[model samples]
Structures are given as C-alpha cells and as structure tokens.
Target chain A: MTTEPPPDAHAAFSAVALTAIDDVYRFARSLTRDEVDAEDVVQETYLRAFRSWHTFETGTDVRRWLFTIARNVFLRSREKGKREVTLDDDGAEIVDAALAREAWSRGGLDTILERADLGPAISTALAELPEPYRAVVVLVDLEDQSYESTAEVLEVPIGTVRSRLFRGRKLLQEKLMQHAIDSGLIPQPTAPVRSTE
Target chain B: MNHGHGSDDRTGAAAMDCAGAMDRLFDFLDGELGPETEVRIRQHLEKCGHCFDEAGFERRFLAAVQAARAAEVCPATLRARVRDALRHAGWTEAAGS
Candidate 1:
C-alpha cells in the first residue's frame, strides 16, 4: 500500500534529501566498502527516506537524518546477527597512546606523513578496519561531521565515537606505517649502538 | 598516564605538563576539549617540544585520512539507480521541482 505524500512534503524531501545523495552515497560506500553493496544500500536508503519524509523534522540536519536511515539500511543488509563491540574507553585510549608512542619511536610517523603518498594506502587500510571503527572514521574524519552528529548517526554515545575514532586512526596509521616501511619511504628500525666506556 | 602537576587553574600560567598535554592530545586535535583545557594544552604545546611533535603528527595523519576519500563521490549509475528507485516508490520530480 502506498500513501502519497503531500506536495509540500515531497518538495521538502526533494530539496533536502536529493541534495544529500552524494554525501549519503559516500557514507554508504564507507559502510559497505563494496561499490555494488553500497549502491544497493543507497537505493534502499532513498526509498525509505522518501516513504518516511513526513517524519523528518524540519530545520534539522537533513544529511544526518538520511545518514541514520542509511546506516540502518546497511545494518539490515548485513548478516542476521549484529556484531556488538564492547570498548573499554580508558583502556583503549591507553593502548592507543602506547602504540602511537611505539610507532613514533620506531621511525618518525611524521616523517612518513611528510615523505610518502598516503592516498592509496589509506583507502586500503580504511577498508580493512573493523566496521565499528571504520564507520566512525568515515563519518567524523572523511565526511567532516561533528561528534554529536556522528554519534547520532551511529546510534552510539559521544564517548564511543571518540574512542572508536581514536582506535580507527591508530589502526589506519599502523597500516600506513607498515606501508611506508615496505615502500622504503622510511628506514627499518635499528637498535642504538651502546657507548663504549 | 601522568596527567600532570595538579593545578586548579587550567588557563593560568601554570598549565599542564607534557604528560597532561599528551593525554589530551587527541581531544585537542579533534577540538573536543573545553576552552580552558584547550588553552592549557596550547600553552603546554608551546613550551613542550615532544608533545608538540606528537600532536603535529596526529594532526597531519588526520588530514591525510580526510584527503584519502576526498575525491570519491556518488557514481552516476548509483545516482540513477537511486533516482529510479525513488520514482518507482512514487516520488515525482514534478512535486520536488
């Protein structure tokens, strides 16, 4: 059964939702990490968005509303069981800091960032990250969304967004660090020579 | 994490130490910290070389991540597919146009 939307409601959806297609598609691609699946997710997302057009509150962010719908669509399309990752925010931050310190000591990550082209490496690495972390990184960093907006989109706490973002960036950095070493952009780690007394 | 020397005033001259600065580095980079804490961290960074370098690396790394997917947009075929799906579900360009 189809319920026709009022003309004004349809116009509003067109103005806001249609304009956000690119952003929504980019977000879906990040979630799916596969072009075909991303297309499917986007198609379904728009369909749902149009049907629920009246439910979207005016003067609020259209992209955020659309993103929430898109995320739900992606989740539904995934396996039957939704994977829940329990994050010990404090512990995770501690580990992330430790790993970052180690990476810095091994061979300056700043040097790698300056010397190497991270575009290809980053895309591959982002694709490889776990969905929980990848989604946060994509929304917050790639899409330039705020923490509050991303939290709402992912249906997680702001703290969760912070932790996931930190973890995601660290994981991606680890991958890029390896790529830099493999590509000879940075020298292999070497032990310091002891001073002879 | 050794947060830093216990100082009640975050924006004062007696700002946090390297440990404190490093602890809040990610939040600082992400603009998630409060203004007072931000000032304190900024002051600490000005005086602390190690923390400053770490923050710089993190900042650049984030910028790189943002750059990686910057060029990607919705493909034309996907756009058409979505539009078609919307039309099939009773959306009309006339209403929107």
Candidate 2:
C-alpha cells in the first residue's frame, strides 16, 4: 500500500518556514541591497518553497534548504550581465596576522571602538562587497551559519566558502579602517612600519 | 609536527607561534578545531599577549557586524503579509481536505 504524508505536514512546514522568515529576509536584503527587491525575493522564495514543500527531506536542515531556494531565486531575478567578482589568487591570500596586530596596536582598535557608532558604515560596506564574498560573509558571519552549511547554500565547495569568508572579512576590516581614518578617529600611517626583527 | 617550542605547564604541549595560532584563530573561534588543536591555540593565547589581542580584535569585529545586521528587523507588516499570502494560496492547509 502507498503511504501519504501526514495531514499536518503543511502546518509543520508553515511553522518552520515562519521561524526562518526573518533570516530569509535578512539574507535577501543583503544580496538585493534594496528593500523592495529584497521583499520581492523573499516572497518569491517562500512561494516557491511552499509549492515544492514535498520535495524537502524531512530530517534535513530546513533553514539551509530555504537559503538555497532564496539564493536561486535571487540569482534568477538578478539582472543579466551583472558584473561577477572573479576569485583570483590575490583574493585568496591568507590575512596578514602580523600586520593586523601591528595595526591594532597602533591605536587602530581603540579608534574603531571609539567610533562605535559604525553601524551605518558597516552596513554600507557589507552591501558594497563583491557578491560571492558578500554571500559567504552574510551566511557565515551575519547568520552564524557553519562554513559547510554556507557552502551548501551557495552551491560551492567548502574551500571556496573558507576563502571567500576570509577575503570578505579582510575587505570589511579595511573598509572600517578607512572609515575611521576619514572620520578622524584614527590617523593615517605616513609610511609602513618596518618590523624591527 | 611539533614546532620545537617549550610546552605550557598547564596544557603540556608546545605553545603555538603567532603564525600558527593566527592561522587557526577563526577555526578556534568557530569551535571547528579538534580538541588538541584547540588546546594548543588556547595555551598560546593565554601565554602570548600579542596573539591574544589579535584574537580579541577579531571577536569584536565579528560582534560589530552581527550587531549591525541585528539592527535591521523584519517589519511586522511583511511577516503578516507573507503569512496571509501563504494561507490564501492554500499552502498553509492541505488541499481539499
């Protein structure tokens, strides 16, 4: 005999979908960078997910599945010929920890914390990041998703997720540093400091 | 391979250097490292001031980004609208039940 899904399957799907709605919207907003566009993407994602609800595996992660659907929707609706960020060798460079330490010690962290009202600056900087890097950062950093989960959402390898996240974070740090210097919270370095060794 | 460094009295392993510790900082912070590697990094952080400061800075930076994202809340109207639309589309209730 053929078996059918539970009668409350729709209710269960609705509950889980609603729970992830805010997160779904946030991800869309980060990608679309426009309120209207983000909302439209979110609505489309939910509608699509609802129609294909039966295809979702029961025990798997619902949020990740939703994110995958949302990402696909965003890509399809995005304008054609949009400039895609090329992940090059330079973009995969490991962050310079020593340089970062030196910068931090040179009143960098102090200046950043002092300019604690950097919410708008941070938001704008995130929105301006290259799409690949931005998506990884939003999923991994903003939403606290694991690198593995983010990879599944973006349909890329875990290595790609790791590299994109590292580069994205470095870019954001640089942007925040620039904002601090522009706001007079930190002074620009005249010449690079030579390591004393 | 061991880095030929002195072992920490508490953790009984050679402390990781700035480069090694920094390389694993994100993984350590994200709880993705193995227990032994995590202990090594933790021991290094406890003994080294510079690496400690760097890790602290990264943690704060992540917190700042999270705070910025948290500031943007999904409007109640949008939530209600999505819910209403789902119900209207008969996605909330089984069809012809």
Interface RMSD of candidate number 2: 5.8
User: After superposition, which runs of candidate 1 have C-alpha atoms over 4 Å from their true positions?
Assistant: A79-101, A104-108, A112-117, A182-197, B1-14, B94-97
Instruction: Give the lDDT of residue B51 in candidate 2.
Output: 91
Cα lDDT tens digits, model 2, A82-160, are: 5434554444442353245446444574457534587777877787665667888988888888877887888888768
Error of 2 at A76 (Å): 2.3
Candidate 1 scores a chain A TM-score of 0.75
Q: Which residue pairs collide in model 1, if any?
A: none
Q: Candidate 1 DockQ category?
A: acceptable
- The clash count for each model shown is 0, 0
Cα lDDT, all candidates: 0.74, 0.72
> Could you give the TM-score of chain B for each candidate, in order?
0.77, 0.72
Model 1 misses residue B33 by how many Å?
1.6
Candidates, DockQ: 0.44, 0.32
Error of 1 at A14 (Å): 3.2
